[model samples]
Target: MKKNLLYVTFVNLVNGFAGIAFIPLALKSLGTEGYGLYSIFVILVSYIYFVEMGVAKYFTRTIAQASNVSEEQKIMRSATGMYIRITLLLFIITPILFFIIPKWVFPTNNHGLVSIIVIFASLDYLLSIPPTIKLTYNLGKEEFEHISKFNLISGLSKHLFLIGSVLIFKSVILLIITVLLRRVFDILYAKKFLKSMPKGSWQPQYAKGEFKKIFSQSIVLSMAQLTQITILSIGTFLINRNFTMKEVGIYKATFDLASKVSFFSNSLGMVVFPRFSSVLKRTEEKISLLNKMPLYYKISWLVYSILFLISLVIIPIIPNILNIQDMELFYLLLYGACLNAHANLSYEFLQADARLKEVIIPSIITLLMMSVIFYLTLDYYSFYAIGISWVLSQVFNSMCMDTMVLRKIRKSSSITTICFNLIISIGVIILYLSLGVY
Candidate 1:
């Protein structure tokens, strides 16, 4: 567990730094409008992968709980077949959606560039399916060291390609092609690693009963994941619809910078999730871990607070560095990120415990509230509308998850932590409002 945590932490740190490094170069090379187009491509590719619908999580839990090697192989075979079908479905459906959705979503943008990006993005995701399934299998097996090593290499190589694409090719089309090729390499690399595992056929082996069982078990998880992705995607969707490509670029860049704070919670959650699933049948052990959740929340809050302070110190200079004009947007989004940092572990625990409705219901409520807030404030606040809605909705969502959902697990201590964090967040908001930045 300690080694896994260390490996995952280092991987996230490297990836985080790479992301931070890429932004400035991308902005310099692509310019704002070009970067906005790249962001659209990235976002669309992520949406395409949503077809997995939490099957990966379901498989991870089942594979982790498997009492024998044969059981594990059975799960892997079923997963491989399911993903193959998903990839084929994507091949058919993605192009049609890409053709229609991009144009509709960004009516004012360049249709030609959109078409190019959509084409490559769809291909990128399709090629990624196999490697993604293999990675999920490794994750279930708690092969964190190998997975992290692969991710480190893959991430470093990807950014190198991305940086090269921008600096050398300076074409969005070439940059996207570079991304597609990276996934091709990832599958080959993943295949080589899979060879070292227990001997079994890696080919697709369709098992209808297994597929139905996994889907039924993970359906609520799928809904929760869909809501989560929609919440993340809606900001980009709204910004693209209402603003210029340049504004979209600025929002995405700032959002990415602010969201780096989440690596702390996300890294910890990833390390703990498999362990949680492995021990799912042990009530006392699970409850003991549940009792420690408040401590986890506190640790997350401390990291968020530290990062928030650091962001304040560096916020002024970021505009000069990134050539962005608005620091207020970063501040608003940072608050949302902080809330996410606090709530992420609790959310993960609920999923690990199969308390899916507790997770999904609050997410649904948050999504509706965020949309309403965006609708009401967009005309008046412009780009700030996205930040405003995100922070406020996150506040409500964090409160719900920490208090209501944690209570379902009989952890009342989390409610106190939630109240304290809420107070701090509210105080920070009031302080930001006093500056009149918005």
Candidate 2:
């Protein structure tokens, strides 16, 4: 687990650096408007994938279960083959949906060439299977170091690849190609890396029925995933409809920076989830998990809080770095980061227990509510309308998750301390806000 998370965190940091590393270049190359158009392409792609319904995510859990009794090699081979077929089908169908969904999902686009590019980019799902299988093995068994090393190798490779591609090719197509290739390479390497581990016979049998059962579950698991996709792109949908692509661009940059930084907590969560799942309902396991969760929450809170504040420091310099001056955009990012931290702490358990519906139902309701509110309020005021709804959405979702999680772990930890901390934090935040952010 140590290696898995450390490697992931390092690579994530690298990816974060790589993004900022290239932003100045991409800013110069794409210009703000072109960058905004590209952001639209990405947002559309994200929306399409989100509508996919969480199948890819279910592979980890199902494959873990399958691995319990099945031979390791057999599990890997069968899972890998099944993953490939489904990913191919998904990639093939994405373009058709890309063309069709915009009719309903959005009014419209320059998706002509970009649609194909996005579709191609989406195919990374196929290449992700082998590493996923390998990683899940480590996760299920608590051998996180193995997974961590693999990620470190691949993440660095990807970072270099991204940087090199941008410097040399400088096209969105090239960037996508680099990303896809890196994933493909990671899967291949991971598959080979697992060869020396426990040996089980490799069976080539199609096992069509078994694979079908797994796939069915995966589809259900994707609902929570789809909720997230909606959240990520829903902002873009509004910005594009009510404002200009340029507004989308500013929003995209703000969200992207926030999302990338926020990704660290995800790794910590990933390492924790399987361990959490592996625990039994006994007081012992709950005690262990409970002791660990707050520590996890504290680590997440501190990391995100520090990063959030640092982003504040960096925001002023970002205009100089990327040559686009929008302080309010960074403000949006900082707010989003705070929300990201709180929301993640709220939902980490939901993912661990495979209770995405617990996570999804609230998120979906809040999303619909926020969307309606934003749409209504946006007519009078634009971005501020979106921000108000965004903050409320996060607050509602976080509180919901917090209430549920605290209930589950209340016997194990200090609710009073948590409540007091929350109250104090809110007071300080309000004071800071009232003082007027510099």
Candidate 3:
């Protein structure tokens, strides 16, 4: 486990660096307005995530729960078939979205560029569905090190091509082109990997039945996931409406840095989620595993805190280089990530047991809180206010989800765990006030 964990963590670190590497070059070459334009497109592309609608999460847990490789393979095939159908549905919807999204997200003057970008981006998202299902299969099987290496190769290749495009083409159109090519390559790679696996018989009847079962669970999970994605991306959308593209660029820069902290939590969470699903029927094992989660929660907070401090030291030295701000914004994002890790884990824990509806209300409330707060505060407050509201909404949602998760597991809350959380909360508050957070 430690070996795999280290490899996965290293891969995540590489992925994070690869992501951040684009910003400086982009800022320098494209300038704030150009980058902001690109950022809006990127955010718009991310809405495809909402369209994905928790299908991958459902696939991962279901595949992980399969009794054997043959069962896992069948699940994979069924998921692929279901995704093919979903893609076909998107084929009808996507054209309309391409027309509508550009008009909604960008200025009317740049409709041509935005329209082209949305079409390509939407195509990229569709092409990615197959490869993502394969990747989820690997994760469900706990092929951590193998998946990590594959991701490293894919990530490096994509970023290297992107960096070259920055120098040679320096066009957002080319950037979207790179995205389309990368998705094609990823799908080919995933197909090659799946072909190497032992073939399992997948009857059309069985595949149809499996799709229905998975789709039923996915409908609920999709709503929950949509809420989560909305909470994360609402800032960009709101900022685009009320602020300048330059301010949008600035806000996105902060959001990106903060999102890197989330990479740490997700790196571990990805590994643990399948394991939780694997042990769902065994109460003793599940309890034992749940008992160990607080340590991980604490570790997530600790790592994020250290990263926050490092950003303080590093951002000032090269403030203009990466478009980094001072510490307050980072702290807000870090705090949000810390609060969110446990809730995210809880969501996985409950989902592992096939409790899809348990989190629906909390998820809805989270979306509402983030939307209301961000909309109300965007005019009166700085971008950091958006960050703060994000953290607060996450806190409320996390508490609600955590309560349900604990009750479902038949575990009483521990005082020590509660104390650790309070300590972290108080410490963050002090740190925020000291930094003159507004």
Candidate 4:
């Protein structure tokens, strides 16, 4: 396990660095108007995570089970094909439906080629297939290390292009071109994993029944996922709706800088899920190991909180970097790290056992809380309050999810465990806020 974490950790660290550059470059190059269009497009597709219907998470679970039952390849190949077909079918139909967002969502004032540049940037979302194969392999072989590695390479490559484009075209077109190119790379890299797949593995024989089973669960899971994505992105979505695109650009850029802390620390949870599922079946070690989940999560929180705080101080030195104020940007930075870790903690403890059913109770409660808070506050407070409220909701959800998960796995949440969580939580919060307050 330690061996596995080493490689995955390295990959995640690098990818985290790269994603940092990627978001900032997009905001800076595209400017505020470009960011507005991009934000709407991202938010729109988040609604379509419902289209994935939860099959991606489904694949993560079933792939491992299918491997245990018969390693020679079973439902997943056809399942992959089916998943892709459905996603593509939905993608094709997307153009026909109403965009849900207001038509006047984008600012009227824009220079030449704004529509073309922004539209191309949006097109990449359509071409991104459901990622069934990559996910399936990941669960089947516990391939998160590889997953992290590829992501690291791709993420770094993306930053390189982003930095280069800022020097070259220095316009929204550069952002558009970079995004489209990245999609092309995403597909090709995903395809590389496809080569190892069995011949004629993806026949339609296993599609209907199994896909439906996974799809049904995915409906609920997708709601949680979409809500989660919306929470992560809702700030920008609201910013675009209420203000001009340029303002959206600065907000997205600042948020992007905040988001890297999330992407980096997230590797721990990302790698832990499959490992947890594999270990759960061993009744001998089950209690002892399951007890470790919260500890690991808190330990990760402590380490990442400190590291991200340092990064927060390091990045915001440039006053006009994102065209937004440093103080509010700092708040978003803190929220991004803390909320991101908390959000991932829900998935780790709740769904790590492959029981999609677990997410229902907590997700329902969190979803409602988030919706109510956002509704009441968004119109009045704009981006900063939006970030604060969202983080508060995640804190609530993470506590609930952690309480349930600890009790279920450990049978008794010991004093030691309780004390550990208290110390970690209090410390992480204190130090994190100190960075912002200073």
The candidate maximizing TM-score is 1
TM-score of each: 0.93, 0.83, 0.89, 0.81
Comparison by lDDT, 2 against 3, better one: 3
Give the worst 10-residue stretch by lDDT in candidate 1: 192-201
> Which residue pairs in candidate 3 collide?
none
RMSD of 2: 3.7
Query: Which digits, one per residue and each the tens of the lDDT, describe model 3 over residues 1-438?
Result: 677678778888898898788777776666666677777667767776666667788778877777887777677777667777777777887789777887765664577877777777678788787668768877877888668877777787788877777777888778768777887888666665443433642322234367667667688878766666677777777777777778777777667766776665677678777887888778898778777766665665566556655655565566465556445666677667667765677777777767777777778778788878887776677666678688888778766766665554334454455556657766766775676533
lDDT scores of the candidates, listed in order: 0.79, 0.62, 0.71, 0.61
Q: What number of backbone clashes does candidate 2 have, counting pairs of residues 3 or more apart or in separate chains?
A: 5
What are the clashing pairs of model 2? 1-144, 3-148, 4-148, 53-222, 54-222
Residue-by-residue lDDT tens digits, candidate 2, 237-261: 7777777666776777666655666
Which residue runs of candidate 3 sit more than 4 Å off their true CA positions? 105-108, 191-195, 200-210, 317-320, 325-331, 408-412, 435-438
**In candidate 3, where is summed lDDT lowest over 10 consecutive residues?**
197-206
lDDT of 4 by residue, 1-438 (tens): 566667677877777766565665665666666666655555555565466676666566556555443442565565666666675666575544433224443434552243453345336555565344665666556766667556666667777876787667766556556767877887777666433445545554464576666666667667666656655675665565566667776766667666666654466666666667667767766677766766765675566556756655665675545344356655645654465575576576566565556666666666567666767886676556656566667667666666666666544554455456556666666766776643
Q: Which stretches of candidate 4 lie over 4 Å from their true place?
A: 67-72, 102-126, 130-132, 171-174, 191-195, 206-208, 308-325, 354-361, 364-383, 409-438
lDDT of predicted model 1: 0.79
Clash pairs of candidate 4? 32-245, 32-246
Give per-residue CA lDDT, model 1, range 1-438, as digits (tens). 888889888998898888777787888888878888888888887777677778888888887788888888877888888887777777788678867865686564588778777777778877887777777778788888788888888888898889889999877788888988888889877876542444573666776587777778877888888887777767878888788989888888888777887776777888878888877679888777767766766666667766776666666644566555367888888889888777887787778888888888889889899989998998898779999999999989877887754574544565687777777777777766775554
